[model samples]
Target: MNDKPPFPGDDPFVDSPLVDSHCHLDFPDFQGDLPGLIERARRAGVTRMVTICTRLRQEPAIRAIAEAHEGVFYAAGTHPMQAAEEPMASVDQLVALSAHPKFVGIGETGLDYHYSADSAALQKESLAIHIEAARRTRLPLIIHSRDADADMADILIREHAAGAFGCVMHCYSSGAELARTALDLGFYLSMSGIAAFPRSAEIRAIFAAAPPDRVLVETDAPFLAPPPHRGKRNEPAFVAHTARVGAEVLGMSPRDFAALTSANFDRLFTKAARTAPSRSGRQE
Candidate 1:
């Protein structure tokens, strides 16, 4: 399962550190090598990373991963694709998990019609529950939508109208309409390595049109590695590549884009920003 490249490129943007707002270091692909993977991320200017827990039952292990690493934080929720299989999550359960100091975000949960259409209803129920937990805890909900733009937008809008909660559309590669809806809702749109693909002009344009402060970047790693490593396993270190493309799309330098996304991450994942020690190991 160790498909990570021998070396993730050199730290070209070391002076301009950024955060990988979404990644899953607790996944089997990173087992036993978490420390090395994190160090690689650090050397490549990824000052912090948020490891996500896609199953509530796995939260203990995922939380342990964050506790063992200095700059790593975690979020927990039942992924939409697993909605039909796992027990529906409750808002109270999620809020209680938020009591942990290292638990910084609410979910990587949302609808996923493309792969699990049969579970759509369950996914929506789970999504609503997560929304309520985020509202209660005042933590950003990390959303994952795929091929369900209209429904996704409707739920987000409906839920937000009920009560305000921060959010980020993690690894966003959906339609421009969904992008617009998310941005209009004061939610952030995160750019992943997919946006760096040569055939992703539309995706790049979607990001380009977004307000600079409303954009974020992620690797979704051990998954979407950006160019120079597109088909290979991804890692937090490679977020620099996606950030480079995001910068180009926004007509800004890589450094500025990194800073912008980091700020957006901090704004959305406020608990992480408040608790994570500054790179210099002191209060900011």
Candidate 2:
């Protein structure tokens, strides 16, 4: 059976330049299709994307993907679910990794009590280390939070209080209180394919309530593929679908919303923005 969902329609924001703020291009799902996947993303007006590395051991491979692709960047950290299984990452080690030009963010790290509640303490410890890395490297913290909103909020609030660090709640589907807390801390909330589901009105409402300037769009590909491609494997190209939904939620045109989120991404991921080449093959 063909699992690929039909494209919604002709592209509406053909001229809009977008960025996939979070994804995992190194995953085996895209093993032999990187070039085609990237071309589709370009055709969808996705000019840049950050491929995240959830485990430190995979950083080399992730870095290579970013290096091989002109518009791709990467971030590395121990994923919360893998906290107990992996060697604890040190702030110094993460800081060292940040020295790469394409290494732009600190983590896809945070709390994931849904599947790994037994490792909550380890996850928290890992999160604190990633937070410190983000602070030291002056890079945005890419957080993956699920079923641990309260602790996530508390830790983020406490960590920020000790010393400020930039962050983005990747695939944010948490409660309003956590959304407010993240926004109050000046962190960005990334809308993933989940936000585009027909049953995601509450998630859409949270985005609607957030400051447009503080919101971003991502695919989190090979995972949550939004409608029109809902049940198929996701890719960076599919981020535009989520962006379209985000545009509707925020009452902006597709092109405008794309530009808005791209700007927001640039603001938070300064390293990527600073070094990313303009479409003309010139430094931006």
Candidate 3:
């Protein structure tokens, strides 16, 4: 009765459940063998995945993947880098498109000073659009912040002031204040494969200190693959490794980590959806 995004199906990880809240399963890397990859993930206990959007131009493809998979869901928005280059999806477009039966969130948007610190105007403009879309649709917005905590925090604060909305700081690697601010603003901080990196001791501490209910896990697959599989292309199945590390850091068992995080995902991303069954298969 406590599960979330409850869909029509049985879940395999009822006891040790985990959700890869962010990934790009629609990318070309999975095109040739999408079904097979998804099947593999199902056997590995990844029952739900949010195939995030990088550009508004790719929303259709992202939507197709979500529609084809029972447990797979999607978000709609243009990435910070693409917002200027590609045709940006207007707030109306995002709200309308994200209303699809399988779509449950908005964005993969936020500042990325790591890539383009020189263009502050462009990044801020891009982020505001997606934030407004999230507000309009009342969907959790997936954010990708990198090397720009102050601006990111400011924007989130500003947008949140206009109206209350939720968002995830996707693959968080920022300092404690940013995490704290995001938490204060009612945002979820998603941890990725980076947590287990030997060099990320400081970041790992920040992650450990985050409020568990406000934390989420992700593989960010096709990137950030975790330990024992760090060098390989990332996938949803490897979320287990990330979960294991998270459990170790938070002083909980992997199974407990699964249960708690799954509950957390439901609370954050699938608020409108029902709790999925305990026997649900991998949503690659």
Candidate with maximal lDDT: 2
lDDT of 3: 0.80
Model 3, 99: alpha-carbon shift in Å?
1.5
Which predicted model would earn the best TM-score?
2
> Model 2, 149-201: lDDT tens per residue?
89999998999999999999999998999999999999999999999999999
The regions of model 2 sitting more than 4 angstroms off are 1-10, 276-284
The list of candidate 3 runs beyond 4 A from truth reads 1-15, 275-284
Question: Clash number for every model?
Answer: 0, 0, 12
Alpha carbon lDDT of residue 272, candidate 3? 27
For model 3 the local lDDT of residue 142 reads 88
Taking all chains together, the TM-score of candidate 2 against the true structure is 0.96
Q: Tens-digit lDDT track for model 1 on 158-265?
A: 999999999999999999999998999999999999999999999999988999999999999989888889788788988887888888999998889888888888
Candidate 3 residue lDDT tens string, 167-230: 8898989888989899999788888999888898987898888888888999898898887677
Ten-residue segment with the worst summed lDDT in candidate 3? 5-14
